[model samples]
Target: MWQPFEYAPKNKIIFGKNSLARLGEITEQFTVKRVAIVTDQGIIDTGHVEKAAYYLTQKNITTYTFSDFAQNPTTENVTAGVDFAKEHQIELIIGLGGGSSMDCAKGVNFLLTNGGEMQDYWGYGKAKQKMLPMIGIPTTTGTGSEAQSYALISDSKTHRKMACGDPKASFRVAILDPSLTVTQPTSVMKATGIDAISHAIESAVTKRRNALSASFSLYAWKLLNANFESMLFSPENEEANMGMQMGACYSGMAIENSMLGATHACANPLTKNYGITHGHAIALMLPHVIRYNADHAQDIYEDLCRISGIVIASCAGKALARRIEKIVAATELPTTLSAYGITADAINNLAVEANEEWTAQFNPRIVKYNDFVSLYNKAL
Candidate 1:
């Protein structure tokens, strides 16, 4: 009784403990000469960017660093990065931090070849030309931007995050070295790990979910649910770190085909106006959104609860809410907006913005403006 569904395009994934050391080999394989390393100042301060730059330098690939990107990348940042790359004649781009750096790199590629502002490509599949060669290296366990074809770029004028999609913006290769994530702050690790869990949970129950996407989501949920606690308890454990990285990557792949739902849609406004980290904002709102969606997608929610090993009397909406509450408690994430200094009145504007987010349309339950308001109020 299943219908045909389009499959997402595949890309190369290089994952391991020392996979970062292969950057030189990858650059040589792609015949890239001048490369731009896109990252933020915090990554540079961590010395990981220097390590990556050294690898490229040893292979005779001239590396230019772009550390001017903001925490939440804006269209202005993308334009500046594009200008730097063009002026330096860079042929390849390496995104070497979390989602912001990777997103900025994708934005840079989109503007470099398409010759338009980020606003022009706000919707899906807008790029007309091939993008420059790009590689993504994730230093965190969230967002999964390294494995996605879409980049979330903020508009400088309105400060709203635009979800821009193009096959050309996909990375040629993603190098996931879990070792790099060990240095993340404890709060960041916990928040991003919760974000990865949200991806798995959301993808499993999204309206677009199919057999293949379900397969990835189920395994991703298992991996994340099992290892997230281990990573929190033993942050430096290589095996646990690898599990988190692999789970996050799989969730990213699932999202590529199925997209995210109400949680992400609601979370975006918090990041835009409240100055919250993307992962933290998403984590804070996810449990309530999951409960909301469970009312409409009970069968899928029960399936996810079973896969995540949450014992319940039945596969009901309340059972899903209890299970999500347990996960949120385990992560030490804030479960309410008030805990994050957001007021109940803020829900009105956030609801207005969430209703306009591109991902809201894909939720299993139709997310109307009133629904967003309710969800925001519930979170508060």
Candidate 2:
């Protein structure tokens, strides 16, 4: 029997090369006089921010820029953005960068309109007031923040990742312009690509998986699996870039309905403690988690393998695990926990934190502290 699931997508997604040209017209629909463009300095350097500003300015919409945020986007960053928005009396927000920018935008929207701290809206649907309208233009093919309602903001003091979400937080428009992503550095491409691939795999067989989510995940995996190598090999491959972009967006849609699984649960502690990039950490843990969940998600894993045309080695789970491992190896990202200086002594502590991650309970297979310990050991 299929699991019952709700599907209410609030974001309007426009996809194509140079689709960003529509930004001014889309913002005009909201009839907003002032808009805030939330992004990082790196994106500003890429000139995407300037381009976005030009579009909005053509419509006579004044644009305010906020780039004071780190890669992980701490809660403090959101506060700063909110303060900036307040000063400008921002009528609408535009997130023009990668996931961090989009997440920071949503985080600002949550606190700016609702009048509270980031922690107050940590889980989901905590905001009672209406949020300001927002647009998201992803310059990277990962995180898929444009297609979803959750903001993964971290606590500045404690450094814990918090997922803040609300229906109002969803973007009013998402522009997937493949032209924007091709300029990303090779390192960023590899890390974010792996992260997008992980999203598809992890969301496919979560405890919350449903027919709707399954469809998205399956197609996302197919596109991501087929195009990831091409994108990495030739960053200027527009067709490959488009495939990866849509794949990442579809993965985000899947995650909206099904959530994630043990890979994310295990990867979080690594990122929190070692400052490992989220995608690199995910690369280290995903294969191990895939093997661990084999007993419960074997059929799902097999389906993924068949769809991706991977030869089943021993079983579907193993084949899928090997495929992921091969992809990580190709990227030259570290595949073992020890490669990041994570020692066996750290396993117990890491496992404890992993067991407490919000996604742990959503794994198709139960992941207890001991199980996390074992998974970490295997990765090591």
Please name the candidate that would achieve the greatest TM-score relative to the true structure. 2
Residue lDDT tens for model 1, 23-96: 99998898888999999888889999889989989999899999887888999999999999999998999999
Q: Which segments of candidate 1 are over 4 A away from where they belong?
A: none
**Candidate 1 lDDT trough over 10 residues, lowest sum:** 315-324
Distance (Å) between predicted and true CA of 123, model 2?
0.8
For model 2, the superposed segments whose C-alpha errors exceed 4 Å read: none
All candidates' lDDT scores?
0.87, 0.93
Writing each residue's lDDT as its tens digit, candidate 2 over 1-380 gives: 96776789898999988998889999999999999999988899999999998998899999999999999999899899988999999999999988999999999999999987999998989999999999999999888989899999999998999999999999999999999999898989998999999999999999999999999999999999999999999999999999999999999999999999999999888989999999999999999999999989998998999999999868899889999999998899988888888899999999999989999999999989999999999989
**Candidate with the greatest lDDT versus the true structure:** 2
Error of 1 at 94 (Å): 0.6
lDDT of 1 at 56: 88
